[model samples]
Target: MSRKIERLINLTIALLATKRYLTKSEIFRSVEGYEGSAETKERMFERDKDDLRSLGIEIEVGSFDPLFNDEAGYRIKQEKYQLDLGAITSTEVSLLSLAAQAWQGASFDEAAQKALLKLNSMGVPSDSLSLPTAAHKIDDGGGDLPLITKAIAEQQLITFTYVDSQLDRHQRKVVPVGLSSRSGFWYLSGVDQDVQEIRTFRIDRIEGEITSTKGPKDFEPPQGFDPARVFDGSSSQSFAIIDVRKGKGTSLRALATSAQSLGEWDQLKLPIYNLNTLASLVLWHGIDVYVQEPLELRGLIVAQLETLVSNHG
Candidate 1:
């Protein structure tokens, strides 16, 4: 592109931004970095004006100009410029502010805060509200979310320090595959280089910067592979299920959605398992959960409950 053309585009954009019409002389004064004779500049402006018109700018020649007597200039109509705020209601703003505060301590995008602020600036009435400043408190100490996000987007392998629920820390080199959220917890699904197996690690448990290894993220998830099934503590060797009811049913539904083979539970005959996953499901679901199948599982639940009662006893 010619320098003249570039400058013309920039000047046109600037003139349109002021929400007012500008004469040729005014536009020339406002536009910088253009050095040419008056006749040459005039010729260039005329060509640029035609170019702008060709580009659908609607550059009016004889537009209203208070400074000149019946002078012509260019103006972008107000209707042409739009920043749709979605007709925000006061109640919606309050609700959005509350929702943003709730994400204060969690992993979130910076754009989220900016978008919230922009919404508030547009008559959202968010100035009186104080959201949790905990969001800003998070530094680049734990996880480099931007790097991880880029790696995930580029389908690149990432190496990072991952700590399990058991508090066991290890350096994990994994092929970054996918990201998901469950029960308000963020999870990163990837293939462990050490184990050659796909696994899901909680994002919060990751306590170090993730480095992109530039390794090919070309591995495919195994056929019939299911992430939710991995969390269920069910493997090719053994598997189990339990009837989860009430909110537990919702959990099971989420699991089923993520991993289709978990199937459904018989609410009347709730299935239970001796597996850690079934136990976790029970514990997570709390006292209202019941063991439906497998007498062994029932015994395991009873044993755990007895231990709990004895601990409190």
Candidate 2:
């Protein structure tokens, strides 16, 4: 790892290690030997804080007294912290198991196994620990499981071939960042080299070797790249607020009835990243949801509706 990233990780580990929050000055004093002067130490502190944020660490800093005006300190929220694996969901247990079973020879296997054991010790029902049908049936085609898992384990890059729903094939190289499960599918979030953008691809669609490649020494993800947004099917490419309504709260016809109906009700604002996905969902679950912002999404939804109607008619 680069010196900056290494120091940042050390700083995060140090912050997470302590119970009481520490002020920036305290942190700088603690890390005085990290090769910097007082001014450089302050800059390093800011950089380390930004790095932590980039890695999705929610560190809060604030002062208790306005009159006294003591230096602000930082602390991780204990409620969201996970020091044990056993408390995680059974589905998560199964996914971990699949990962373990698929790539046992990887460098992180022992650690992962220990984590799995910790989870198994937890109260997840025995039956629920079994891998789901989708996961169990996924053939690896005798591919290099160790290499793939190592890539994920070491936070490296991996390239693979995937077959889309249309039966078309494409080769994609991605810097694997995270993995997640939603709606009964496993998805890998990564930065696509070809597109030069972050994207989520269904693991089941993956058709070839998960080749391990050296990660870019300094590549970093852009801010606000939430992997879940891709599967949620509603995210904005840029910062843009849009409104939404739940199906249960209001009828679609009622919502569209009059200016009063639309104005008087509360709305759910969202940043749509994939408008096409949102359009498809609206078509699939008609009258159950409403898109209230970014008129473009509304237009896309209308177009999708017309396409569906024409095809069906």
Candidate 3:
């Protein structure tokens, strides 16, 4: 971890550990990371406060005496800082863990880990029960979600390198209107300014950091635009058949539109958005999942496995 992050975590832990607000002088002396001149420490504290607040962690700022309005103190309130989800079940824990995993290598990894630690303190023991649901998670574009979501909320245009299905890389400028997750993969629904079309970019396919386009971005989506329906209204629907081992691939079982029990295994029929996506989910299951149909989907998985073996060998 970097010094800034370590200092921020230390600062947060201190504030949260205290029941009452701590004054700046007390924090400088108590917090382990503060150093250098008093003025330097003061600047660091201000930036740290803003950084924590940017990540949705609220820092309570107030005075001990309302009438006197004395020197202000800072602290994080448990009620405001912690997740509001109460009485979470084991299944929920697994799902939450999977969500947390998406941030493992992302910029928000530390903050995500903080939330997971909070879960442990909540007396909810996480488990491997969401094996099937866990398959829905892909680590691709999730890391850049903090920036993308921020841009969407602020209605800004972003530029990034995108790797297409053909293994070609191209720079893309998109005014993200909204974002949607389907089949465990996230897709950014936006107005592609370069192509001048309503386009959807799979988050996993993005090649690098998504930076904002220069100048002011007051872009808007088409009137009455709906992101969730970006993949809707296709002329034909496609489906995939996966034979999953019994008591495994729970997420697949839940998403299956139809299923047939086969003694030791379950044959599942699921609507598929694309062969690549279906292959990605199937790969997550490893030997536990087998594509029963759609030669294309099965071929994709087989090819990926072949490449994996070749590279390691």
CA lDDT, every model vs. true structure: 0.64, 0.64, 0.82
- Pick the winner on TM-score between candidates 1 and 3: 3
- 10 residues in a row with least lDDT, candidate 1: 257-266
Cα displacement (angstroms), candidate 1, residue 58, comes to: 31
In terms of lDDT, model 1 sits at 0.64
Q: Give per-model TM-scores.
A: 0.43, 0.42, 0.49
Ranking by lDDT: 3, 2, 1
For residues 68-161, write the lDDT of model 1, one tens digit per residue: 5866777666445334656777777776666655545435535558657866777656435555554443322234566667776676788888
| Candidate 3 lDDT, 75-161, residue by residue in tens | 899888877796789889877777887665656677779878877777777776735553443454456777887888777889989
Error of 3 at 120 (Å): 3.4
Q: What are the clashing pairs of model 2?
A: 235-272, 235-273, 236-272, 236-273
Task: Output the lDDT of residue 142, model 3.
Answer: 51
Candidate 3, which segments miss by more than 4 Å at Cα? 1-14, 17-21, 25-57, 64-69, 98-118, 126-147, 160-172, 180-186, 192-198, 202-209, 213-226, 234-313
Candidate 1 matches the true fold with a TM-score of 0.43
Pick by lDDT: which candidate is best?
3
